[model samples]
Target: MSLEKLPPLLALVCLAVPGTALAVKPGGTLYIKAKNTHLKASSSPTADTLVVLQPGKEVTYDSREGKTPWYKVTVPVDKKGPVQGFVYQANLSVSPPSLEVTSKSPDKPLSPEAFASSGAAVKALGPGAIAYGKTLSRPDSVQQLIALESLAASIDTAQVAEYARAGGLPEVVGRPQVARRSPAKKKGGK
Candidate 1:
């Protein structure tokens, strides 16, 4: 509104603008060696399936897929030969190797039947069963049991029992017995 106010406003605007002093330029290219002889172009680096890229092909890197460190690059060939492999960021950085969970103490082995059943439950219920199982396996208390019962109701009973059995519950209490005879039995039959 006034000359004095205009200088203050201009100074505020400059302060608000970040990195105004720095000359910004386009992003630069990165040169990376293939960590593996063959690398995979996945929808995301964490994807199970990988589109194979042959080793030693120098390709230009492109944008990232989210905040994940994965970089997408273009492949030179379409499914045919004289194919040049492309570059992508597979986020597979080297850190300390992961520790394997090996049983140290001699514990009783799991029954094959129980193992199979638990595996089936995991396949059927996906992450829900896994998460519920983790909660159920915690130190038992009245509240935990109540929570487990609620979670179990949301899952297939057979599957829940299977998981319970596998998780070292000596027996899954109150598992329903399979119905053998029909309710409408022959007249006078005991």
Candidate 2:
């Protein structure tokens, strides 16, 4: 192309550059804090998952921007080199998580069953909650709340995901963005 055309082409390229989606520079390293958190394609929780990251896995990340609760990260996958994606900020930590140990053995990590059975994992309703429940008209409400709490505590993440899938919920069971609804108009009113 002629020099005159080249200048305009370069100007157009520069103008389009900032608007295009591009990966950010590595800001720091972070470790996965959860057992099976996903590296998603976008910042949204329901976005496509690039990979499932395990607890304590190290990943390179870009600094968080604005009020967003997602971090852009590059995770090293087996045989696939490094893959860039967004992970929930809550799932990442600046330092690796120390494995929870059983009371009997300080060196060994606590098994899932052991943790579930431990006193630390099971918490009864506090006196305040019980008192509040007493104020409610339904005398059996407290017992129902206790039952519901027990049921929720017993269900694991895997079980919840499976239940969602079986019930025809969204394929990606990760936290979904809250949709905003427009205000309803009154009859004959614009």
lDDT tens readout by residue for model 2, 1-190: 4668888887789788762434334666788876567777778756666677666788998756467988888888778478787888778776677656866677777544345456555667878998899898996888888899898889777776668668976333342222221123112545
Candidate 2 ranges with C-alpha deviation above 4 Å: 1-26, 100-154, 160-190
Q: In model 1, which regions exceed 4 Å deviation? A: 1-32, 35-51, 78-190
Clashes of each: 0, 0
Error of 2 at 58 (Å): 0.4
* Model 1, residue pairs in steric clash: none
Note the Cα lDDT for every prediction shown.
Answer: 0.40, 0.68
Give candidate 1's root-mean-square deviation (CA, Å): 22.6
The worst-scoring run of ten residues by lDDT in candidate 1 lies at: 91-100
TM-score per candidate, chains pooled: 0.24, 0.45
What global local distance difference test value does model 1 have? 0.40
